[model samples]
Target chain A: MSALSLHGIRKDYGEARAVDDITLDFPDGQLTALLGPSGCGKTTLLRMIAGLEVPTAGTVTVGGRDITRVPAHKRKFGMVFQSFALFPHLTVRDNVAYALTIAGTARGEAAARADTLLDLVQLTGFGDRRIGQLSGGQKQRVAIARALAQEPEVFLLDEPMSALDAKLREEMQVELRLLQQRLGITTIVVTHDQREAMTMADRIIVMSKGRVEQAGTPQEIYHWPATGFVAGFIGRANFMDGVAQDGRIMVGGVALSLPRPAQFLTGSAVQLVCRPEGIRLGAGLAEVNSIEGRVTFVRDLGPVRDIYLETRLGRLVAEQSADQSRVLAVGDRVHLSLPPDALRLYPGLPVTLPATALAAE
Target chain B: MTVAAQIGPMAEVPPALRWGAVVNLLLWAIALLLCLVPFGLVLLISFGHKVEGAGWDWAFSSENYLRFFVGANWPAETTSLYLGQLYWSMRYAVVAAVLAVVTALPFTYLMTRQSRRAQARWLVFLLATLSLSEVFIVMGWDIILSNNSGLPMLFAASGVTDWLKDTGWFDVLRDWGLANPRNVKFKTSEFATVLTLSYLVWPYAVILLYPALSRLDPSLAEAARTMGARPWTVARTVILPAVRLPLMGTTLLLFVFLLGAYVAITVFADPSQHTTAVSIYENVRGSTLNAPFGAAQSVVLLVAAGAFLVLGQRLSRKSQGGA
Candidate 1:
């Protein structure tokens, strides 16, 4: 059964809708990530589930019970905030034991439980330290320990890794994921970073403009995006506008076939996206959709090389492994391939005219 | 070394350093004259002997201290009159400061939750009331508390006084000295004195607490709420503990400020219940005309204020260290 569910949740502030008609379910013992850019209502949706926000018009259900009217304190959902929000006046042990103490637990029992939780988070022997004395990662661990001390039905985190440095954020993401899996608690994390979401979530929900763009497994989201926005947002993709003619897409008069026939009717405007790594560089034996272009820029990342080319179709970026012996410089001429299986087509008028058409004119 | 390199920045250093030292010395001298000299003169006069007619002359003696502790005719018969005045002074200041802070705490917490524009408006209103002269404030309260016209007359006009008499609560009020022969009177009572003193320092309490309460991390409260803490529990466990030091410090400061209050005490307190501040006025410029004794009282009040300040600092520091 789904542990928590939000149905048609909406939050309207004046004329602006912070969260618009979001309906989602968090499966039990699974971690879900609400991923989006800044101001995309992911945090708002999370807050509504946490009972921190009252929905304008919707019902929230948990385990077959309607808890829409329940306030935050009554819900007892453990949440780790972006700032951690540890009480500076309390020692680490007291901070972890706060929920237990407030719930009328005995001091000895609460302290024992706090110690166990601190051990769970690998923060042993640091119980007597002040909150201000902890490092950023240590503070985050204490927050997690405090939240888990309640053994809440649902755990929520809002940008929990944003305050940590890049290196520590990645490590904590993996560590948090392991801890959540071991406990098998229903958890939801709100994050703007796609990599973090992919690393930690069992399922990822992509949101934009206060609406859910797509929700699926990370691989499915990466391999098959339901919208042009989702495709561009989830990963780096080179977009090209074309018109569907017969069973092929015509891009600057070069007809490129898709793995499956175009879904849109002939003569309808369509957008095509291909991942950079899917595009092969240099001449191949078969040249079905090959384009001649000059290299305008070469970015040599340690593991991969991104080759920027001004092609007849458009300005396309192609990626190659750094281990490959092909060394290309700026102003070098090259032929790029757009494989049929790697292309994704969506029906929409192009937002900007493709550079190929501008060159053709 | 090269001439340009040697003289480039070093040549300008000596004159600037000399000018800075001169300005620093001048500021220290002025500070000493303006801040310390008057206090020194007060201390010096505190030990001087009071002359016979109207003035006092410089002489090292402990007569003023002796008179403060006991009666003027010590060793023969003792009187705790001045000591009683000192006690009333501390009692009134303590009660009024505590009442003001307790009341202002809720107001300040609520005010800080408002928008900046609304907070600014509240500050303006509070400052306007805070700047009102003590004499004017005392007069205003006097009109409200007087037996002939204010609350007592209003109670009579509204039949509440008769109601109290019927309920036999009037006897209790009379026993407490809050009522006269026929009607309930508030003037010249401890109730009226402390009330007016609390009102006088209430705005100051709000202003002093504004910064600490406003800077409090609201997320801390919400975090507690999510941990299954009720609103009251969150306040007790999170908000109160966080602002504990500020509350104590604000109370101490308001107490010290109320120590020197003159008009409120003189107008509302009975003559026998008046504080050391009123006694200082009587000795300095009133009928007594004894300046040295007044200086001695002023020094005592200053010392009391300083003691409370140091106590507050130690308490805050201890709390911080314990945390």
Candidate 2:
């Protein structure tokens, strides 16, 4: 049985539908990230699976048992909130043992269990300390220990690393992922940070406007985005509005040949999406499919260098690892390559053309 | 009368005192004299003796304290009557304050969870009720709980009293001093006094607990729920523990406020069950012309109230320091 399965779950807050007909299955013993921007309802979807929210339409099943109407308490799914939410009054031990103590376990057993769970999160001797005494990372570890005390069937976290500073966030992400994998508990995380999702999630579901645009592995999401929103949201994409024709696509007045003919009819409007890294750069007029352009700017991000160009088609960015031999300065005329395999086609509309598309070279 | 936190260890006049040094010194001298006058009078009166056919005479005497503690003729005669009144004052204050705080806690939590606009509306309502005169609240409860009208009348009119009588539950009500032989009654009873006193401080309890409960981080309780706690468990393990200090502090505050309750006890308590407040009122202004004895009782009440306040402060400090 899948660890948790949500079937056509829909949640509507009055006239507005916060989560629109989301059907997702979290595989056993793997962490999945519901990745989206703000107001995308990724957090709402996670809350529903945790039973904190009641779906307007459809059922939630965990371990093959229908738990659609089960209240949050009975579902017993442990969750870590974005804020860490450590109880201020209780010591770390009492907070971790709360679930067990409230379940009517003996105090000794509950405290012992709490100590072991704290140890699992690498906060053993720190149990005697109050929550306010700990640093942000330690508090986050305490939250994790408290949530994991129940040994829940599915673990849920909502932007759990957002409380940490930029440096610590990346470190905790890998540590948390390793812990999740070792415990082998199915987990779901909701986050807007794409890098964190890509780092921790075995599968990533990209959502926008309360609907899932695409759900797949991080590589699939980054490399083969199924929609224009996914293509734009997952990473930086250079998009060109064009028309599909016989064995080629025409963007503005420039006709580019594809690897094969598109299923889209000729003259049909489409969008051509490609990652910045896939486009190669070299001197003027070096190869086929090379577009003549001037290097308007160059952004050197340490190991990777991005060369911005302005061409007839439009402004576009090409990222290449900084090389010891080849150096392209600003205003240098160059030819940029758009490999056919690296390109994706989408239906063009106003919303899909994000600010990144219109960003100047 | 006492100003809390008025004095600290380190004190030096700052440049913020806009009035020049002489003017500031004069102002402080006047303020200090004015604030000390009433307390000085109370102390002086407590050591003075009432003179027959005259007003009073200043003299050094332990007579007033002895009378307040035991009775006027203590060496030759024994009487515990006045001490019993003081005991009831403490008893009623403790029970009413605790009841008020315990009930106000959940109500305040729910009130805090409301949106800011709703919270503002609630604050207006609570403040309005909180600032209302104690005499008016006593009047309202008196009307509601009096035997001739209100709850008793409603009970009889709705057949509840008859039902209780038929079910043999009237005996229980009678045992609780909440009913008479003919019908249910509340006047001149401990129940009435306690109920009225709790109602008097109920709004105060909410007001005292408001800032603490309102400023409470709700994310903590929601987080506990996410950890698989039931509603009751969340309340017990998360909510209750979080508000313990506020709860104790509010109770102590209400207790001090109720220590000097005047209207409720006078109206509801039996003559034999009258409290120290009644004795103070009698000696100060009513039938008894023993001003010194009344001052002595007032001093005792003040000491009790101050002691409780200091204890509450120490407890709150310990809790916050530990955290």
Q: Which candidate is the best by lDDT?
A: 1
DockQ-based class of model 2: medium
Q: What are the runs in model 2 whose C-alpha is more than 4 Å off?
A: A245-247, A265-267, A284-288, A356-361, B1-34, B314-323
The reply for model 1, stretches above 4 Å from the true place, is A265-267, A349-361, B1-13, B159-176
Model 1 C-alpha lDDT per residue in residues A116-183, reported as the tens digit of each score: 99999999999999998999999999999999999999999999999999999999999999999999
Residue lDDT tens for model 2, A161-184: 998999999999999999999999
Worst 10 residues of 2 chain B by lDDT: B1-10
What fraction of native interface contacts is shared by candidate 1? 0.87
- Provide chain B TM-scores across all predictions: 0.93, 0.88
TM-score, candidate 1, is: 0.93
Candidate 1 lDDT, B1-323, residue by residue in tens:
99888777645557889999999999999999999999999999999988888499998888888888887899898999988998899999999999999999989999999999999999999999977989989989999999997999999999999999999999999998999889999988999999999999999999999999999988899899899988889889899889999899889988988988899998889999999999999998898988888888889888877887898899889978877
RMSD score of candidate 1 (Å):
3.7
Assess each model's interface with DockQ, reporting 2 decimals per model: 0.74, 0.52
* Top-TM-score structure, candidate number: 1
